[model samples]
Target chain A: MLEATIDASLLKDSIESLSVLVDEARVHISPEGIGVKAVDPANVAMVSFELQADAFDEYQAEESEIGLDLTRVLDILGVAEKTDKVKMKLEEDSRKLSISIGGISYTLTLLDPSTIRAEPRIPQLELPAEIVVNGKGFSRTIKAAEKISDHMSMGVEGETFFLEAEGDTDRMRQEMPRDELISITPGPARSLFSLDYLSDIAKPASKSNEVTLQIGNDFPIKINFEIAGGRGKVGYLLAPRIESE
Target chain B: MLEATIDASLLKDSIESLSVLVDEARVHISPEGIGVKAVDPANVAMVSFELQADAFDEYQAEESEIGLDLTRVLDILGVAEKTDKVKMKLEEDSRKLSISIGGISYTLTLLDPSTIRAEPRIPQLELPAEIVVNGKGFSRTIKAAEKISDHMSMGVEGETFFLEAEGDTDRMRQEMPRDELISITPGPARSLFSLDYLSDIAKPASKSNEVTLQIGNDFPIKINFEIAGGRGKVGYLLAPRIESE
Candidate 1:
């Protein structure tokens, strides 16, 4: 059982972070907070999201896991004003979620957790380099890269972090030194990633003030950021596309 | 020959005023200003547009008629910021229009005026009633009506101007008494129009401060609004859809 009241935008942004990777997600609700880990159908990208109980004005829950159809929730939230407070309550007997905003109440049928694909084990890797940059600038770089190629390379050299994309006839690149970035732990790190995943992930990251990136040679890159005014956290892992010489 | 430089937004908005009704149009350029009059393919609606010379920062031209593919111009303008200065010049010998924004230059081939449809003759309609209202409010009313039906009715009764739409199961109405409107010349006037035309026309109309509407029973409706800080004017005439009763 779960009951909570939170800002509409907070919940909407949290759901959007995970929805960028998967249509359906298994959400774990507890007295501490709400958590969701989902992988895209192609298994090329994964998203892990967590919202602390402090993010909500009121919160109460028993340890429980439920499946959610993110698209449907987004549709309902679309009608809510950003400043409005959203109230959500789960009916254990009916297996439905009751969401109310203003005077409108929407009853959404919940999906069964057992029917969803089992959550994958998150791999642990000690990536050698870490870079913390302004989310807006990083998002802009990814958007500009999209015009040049389907895939782009990110690397750290000395005190600078660089992102570059190359096409047959066009190229784009952006570099930020340690002085320009929020922070940097430069090392030997470079990897190529598909714009498809970076572009979707950028939408949510753009709203954050600081986004952290961990990279290693030819290894999956991890992106981490905070949402809901630093009360919530979101992380994304994208498999790199190895260049063919 | 013509050579002119103007704010990108002013030119874009003026062209948009006419493009909403037709994809291509015959433009008349003179030292006085620029003018265009065209009817949609179905000949159900017609648009008249004008941008005075004073609206441009630099203006020079000879009396000339050119066929413009509005889609192409809008595409080029899409890359320009609203504040950017757009320079346009006609090359009579090459039958092309040279448009420059910032450092980018695009030479667009002009269509042969004779190959395009002949300009339509705007019928002189003596509508008995006139209502002047806030463009934003009028635009909002039209948008709300769209949610109910494909057609909407406008009429004046005594001191109030009323706009309404009705569907099989839903209806919407917005009434502005003389006190609420900027001005009103009330009389026996009512007409029904298709939303397809009003919705498109509303795109540019919504930006104006005041919009004037003239109506007559079962007759075409005339809508007039200004652009470019009143330096430009646009008028539209749409045939009414007679109720099948």
Candidate 2:
């Protein structure tokens, strides 16, 4: 059972982060916080999200697991203003999520959690390079790369972090030296990633001031960023796409 | 031959106004100005647009009649900044329109004028009801109506001007009394129009302070708005849908 009120924008942000990877998710709600761990259908990406109880204006819940359709919730939130407080409660009888904004109420049927894909284990990784930069700047670079190619290479060589994409005739490269980045633990690390996953991953962090990236050669990258003024955290793990020489 | 240089935003606005109704149009470029008159495919609406030479930073023409595809021009302008100056010149050899904005050069092949639908005669009718209101307000009402229905009624009753849309189970109505309206010449007139046309025609005027609407019972409504400041004028005539009682 869960009944809480949070900023419409924060909830929308959280849902968007989850929707980018999985359409349906089994959300774990406890007095401590809320969590969603899901892997995309293609198994190329995994999303791990947690929002502390303090993130909500009013939060009270018993430990419960509910299956949610991210897209449906997102649509309801779409009509809400960023500053509006969205109250959500799980209806006991119908097992539906009731969302109330002003006078409007949206009831979403809880899906059967057993129908959702099995949760994936969080992979332990010790990436050699770490880069911290403005999330919006990184997102923009991803978009520019999208205009030219479908894949981009992320690497750190010495003190510079580089994002490069090559099309048949056009190539795009964005470099942020140590001075330009928030922080960089640079090394010789390179990994290619599909823009399809990279672009959507940027949605939740687009407004963030800083984003952390942990990368390794030909390995998955771990992206972590804070939400709701550090009251919430979202981590994305995207498997790298190998590039043929 | 035609040559002109204009602010990227101004040209984009003008094209967006006409593009809302017709895809291809015959653009008449004369020494004094540029004009486009065309009708939508369904013959439900007609758009007439004109920009005086004053609208351009530099203008020169030889009364050329060339066919243009608004969608293509709009695509090129999509990449330009608001302050960028777009220089357009008719290629002498290829008969293509060469659009140059900084380093980007887009050559759009001109369609044969004869291939486009014949220009329609501007219908002359005196509409009794005139209501001037914020274009954005009207546009927003149309968008909100679209969320519930495909058709809406526009009318003037006493000192109030109203737009009402009714769905099977929902209804939305927006009224602007004389005090709220910029100006009003109240008359007993009501007309039902398709949101498909009304929504798009409001694009160019969405940000404008004032939009002039002329309506008569079961007759075509004339929407007049200024674009590119006062240097350009756009008029749209939309046939009203007769309400089946």
DockQ of each: 0.04, 0.04
Write the residue-wise lDDT of candidate 2 on A59-146 in tens digits: 9888888888787677556656668898889877536777766434455668878888867899999999999989999999999999
True contacts kept of each: 0.00, 0.00
**Estimated TM-score for each candidate:** 0.55, 0.55
How accurate locally is residue B52 in candidate 1, as Cα lDDT from 0 to 100? Answer: 93
Cα lDDT tens digits, model 1, A1-245, are 89999999888888889889888888999999999888899999988889999999999998998889999999899999979999999898536999999779999998998888778777897999999988887777776667557999999988889887876543555677788889999889999999989999999999988999999999999999998788889999999999867
TM-score for the A-chain in each candidate structure: 0.98, 0.97
Once fitted onto the true fold, the runs of candidate 1 whose alpha carbons sit more than 4 angstroms away are: B1-245
Clashing pairs in 2: none
Q: At residue A1, what lDDT does model 2 achieve?
A: 80
Cα lDDT tens digits for candidate 1, B68-161:
9887678657756668898898996637787766544456678878777888889999999999988889889999999999999999988899
